[model samples]
Target: MRPQALLPWCLSLALAVPLVGLTPASARAATDYQAEDAVISQGTVATNHTGYTGTGFVDYTNVKGSYVEFSVSASAAGTSALTLRFANGTSTDRPMDLSVNGTVVASAVSFPATADWNTWATRTVDVPLTAGTNKIRATATTADGGPNLDRVSVAAAADTQAPTRPGQPSCSDIGEDGLTLAWGAATDNVGVTAYDLYEHGNKIAEAPGNATGKALTGLAPNTTYDLTVIARDAAGNTSPASLVVDCTTKPSSDTTPPTRPGTLAVSGVTANSADLSWGASTDDRAVTAYDIRSGTTVYQTVTSGTSATLTGLACDSPYTLNVVARDAAGNTSDQSNSVAFTTKACTTDGGVPSSIATLSTGWTIPWGTYWMPDGKTALVTERDDFRVWKVTKDGTRTQVGTVPNAVTTNGEGGLLGVAVDPKWDTNHHVYFMHTAAEGNRVVRMTYDGTTLSDYTVLLKGIKKNRYHNGGRLAFGPDGCLYVSTGEAQTPDLAQDKNSLNGKILRMTTDGKPAPGNPFGNYVYSYGHRNPQGLAFDRNGRLWEAEFGNSSKDELNLIKPGADYGWPTCEGSCNVAGMTNPKATWNVSEASPSGIAIVRNVVYMASLRGERLWRIPINGDNESVGTPTAYYVGTYGRLRTVTKVPGADQLWLSTTNCDNNGGAADGSDKLFRVTID
Candidate 1:
């Protein structure tokens, strides 16, 4: 006989007879059945279990293919909630497959372990059931078999609510051939399952409910499209359509390609990179991108521009770069004249010192360091203290004077970037970049070896932000002062040629634009994110180190009027009209701050990376070799590194007093480093 037939007569009589004035069994709520009351196919009844309602519970065999079956009755063919009570005394979970009638409803239903064997828990799942009597079976999936079987209950589930309407749709990444549309997520009473994308009234695409966007391709150029989105739930109910978004693709009318770019020229060749430029090309529509090709491979694609920096080349290697123009319709023009160039040969032996000697301690957030004409005395500027110090090789330091009219409102702004005049003995002029009440400015002061006076403001229009006030000052090979400025976190300013921010500015000692500036303005190079390091190689090539946002940190070779591709290309991207970095490091390894060239080697100081990177400069300063790290994590945070004049040593400053470093105030130090 079945296990149901073994139930006690007294309990069966109580279930058959309803209470006085109560409804009959057919009209009553759903019923629950204990595991032992059902047909136990392969399990033993355990009466020692506590917290169970029935006389006993089933403990299934710990072998493969163990199961318990329940005969259930439902009023109609619809959704029903199936709740199973069980206990897992073992440390591992026991999973089972649930089947209703003959169809599998849920797979791998987990029966997690409780506190003890006496503890019980319920796992409810929504399953479809047919009218009349049906069989519900729980079969073990693993050899360990199912958990201790307690009881199984069934209840009807009726869902009618639809998902909430999707948020307004927006379009982006619009191109001649494709575009992307995105919207906010929609919520549903039940779980959402999928979404449908509509173009006009017809459905064009479908996405998972969790997906918030979709990309549509194979689009006609110069065409406009109306797009909307609808969210669907697991029950087949869909929400109202999202707000329509209009997207227009780039136009493609004229098949005529741009005229072949001419006058290809290569400059600033380094060990691993070169700067290439050519005359602008003309097209019937408009030249959209220029493909810089090396042999058959496209080196870089620039947008609507005629120049780009070719990076990541091999040292002492020859390359032939050709320019090709393309229009909106993707028509390519004839290749321009090819230019051949060779990278410089490596100079250093590619080794870095494993140890450093302390020079001075207790400095506060030193931002810039420069060697004086005397070759033994060095000058250091503190970003937060707005003070300058004159230090000797033996670690003796003196407070020369405070920068006049300097103010510090943000963490990055204040007195920064100090440069000694190349003709310091005669002129005694020292230039500085500092923050004032108005903005960040450059000023010249007179230093007579002991004291500083005669402060004169030369240039003052560069925008300043709480952070990213790129204040690195140096005298270029042309004997003019070079200033690096940040975009003040304003992205568009990086692309604006007229903005002083997001550029490397070159000017005379009196603060006027340098005579050979490319744009007739102070701007030397534009599109810098937050460049802080500037060093000139033996070949007069200027190398810059910049802090990148999340993606990459860059080491750029500066060129006149060149765009370094800040907001457009973070590192080495294929975008057109922007110059790529010669070398890039992950942000964690190289938040590169200060750079110096010593013995034909580029030494970069990292703040967050807390290391010094040494890059070997090749012959003619054409390229650079692989970089090796030193003093990693041994030092707190390195801020600046400058070559000592007429010596084989470099001055390294620490910036542990600022917010990120977390070092105690007055705990920073200055080190004299010797690279072998």
Candidate 2:
């Protein structure tokens, strides 16, 4: 049986789901109940597959009678659409019986293959529902069990409110043939479903609710047209028409091509995606779009922004990218300068994480974990409280001592990273990075097996903010101390080589700059936003993971004097001097924290993403493999992960008591994960 099979039954989640993509005739307000949050029999909640919504999905065992049941509520009893979003990777169809209340409403419902586990498809059925609450259950009829169940959305309540009026219509990129129309998004009680564009009271085009901009094409040249927009709700209620914009198209008979886009740059080149940006091109009419070419083939076409991200590229492969601008007359410009780049190598072990058991519990915001030289015990730090505890391998925890003079920033501050000196057996020195009244500081203390004493300040000068106080410390294989510092929410500090903030600092045991330093200062590598994870691979090469602002989070390979773009670049960009990340993930997928390497695999702990990521380091010792997430949404707010010395196992800790975690004190726990 899978380790997760032993977890307690999942409780029903009560949440509202927006009604989207529905036509007015069939629109109904809906609520989504995650499969993982429903009652399961002979199944487990899993995150191994991508595209599962609301944390995870219920993975059923290949046995008859496997089922997941959800409790749903409706305002009134009536016929409603029950949408089941699922994925089946196998070629064989998995048929299931859907039961409402206690009666089977749909029998032998076929769930066809969706290509792969990553691909999702939804099946909708009109079912009779009672007022108030109803129990909906789906059971596998054959030994193949049911398809991987994502969630079930019940559309019951009627949405009657119309969407608010859209913002006044505006025109841009006007040309002789066509122009671009844009307006602000309209608000709806349930959700806006679509928008209709009208020209002189006749509807000409339609766009999805999520879109605020539409490209108007196939219009007559040299003409004046008045355009307006109307927002529509799922129930077919249309908002008041937006104010009209009078746009005059340019004269016809023009065939001038646009100038080539300038200075094509790429950065944040990951295994599958690269960021591309170039100077805008000018045209006699209007530049309609920029076609990004991979060699001779157009990889992507950008219509609005000067930047475009190229995705779906192969790992560890070379690619030459150039941009060509196009005018309204279909005339194309010359190709821009070619920028040749190689995507980062991605490797994977395909290991699935099974919960062995919770090793320790009742701890609050356990921030850092580091094994002792003896390999039988480890020291842990609590972020909010300046306390240190020595935890044995068998789960015995003893509060050793608290670091004095440590102050809390009240958010993401207080006692943070803890690292035992590699020569601790002889020197008995242990180090800590914490927030102090002055700023963030690195301090050294003497640990004599059972207790901690002799506190001494090693280094200071790293600025601290209410947030972004980077506080992770480790001793590199070269016997030098490596510290990861945050930018203190100051983006400029990351690009400033002279500032210690937003940098990976390398220092001696006494806190002076390490020998052969990059800038003759403590700064080893500049340009980091909020670097938290720092671990050395088996090849003695450093790897770091940090949080991204709004778009992407990054996992980068650290090098001496390498500049990692911060405010200037989020994920992958084509900046000239900035180094790109080896892997990039959506911020919703990886607000990463501490990382540890075991058997050449870097295990990263995510905070907001709430998962443990395993990324394999290739034999080349430089590029990383495809990153896979494990225990996603199963554990809340993973804070730190550390390799158990001399073992193929890792110790993971959680910070459920943090502000974002929102759990009560003593709600956190420590877990042990074995890599197979």
lDDT of 2 by residue, 147-244 (tens): 99999998864544668879988999988788999999999867788988866433578899999999999986777787778788755566656767
Q: List candidate 1 segments past 4 Å from native.
A: 1-351
Cα error of candidate 1 at position 419, Å: 0.6
Model 1 worst lDDT run, 10 consecutive residues:
19-28
lDDT of predicted model 1: 0.80
User: How does residue 506 of candidate 1 score in lDDT?
Assistant: 79
lDDT (CA) per prediction: 0.80, 0.82
Off by over 4 Å in 2: 1-355
lDDT for position 386 in model 1 = 87
Per-structure clash totals for the candidates: 14, 12
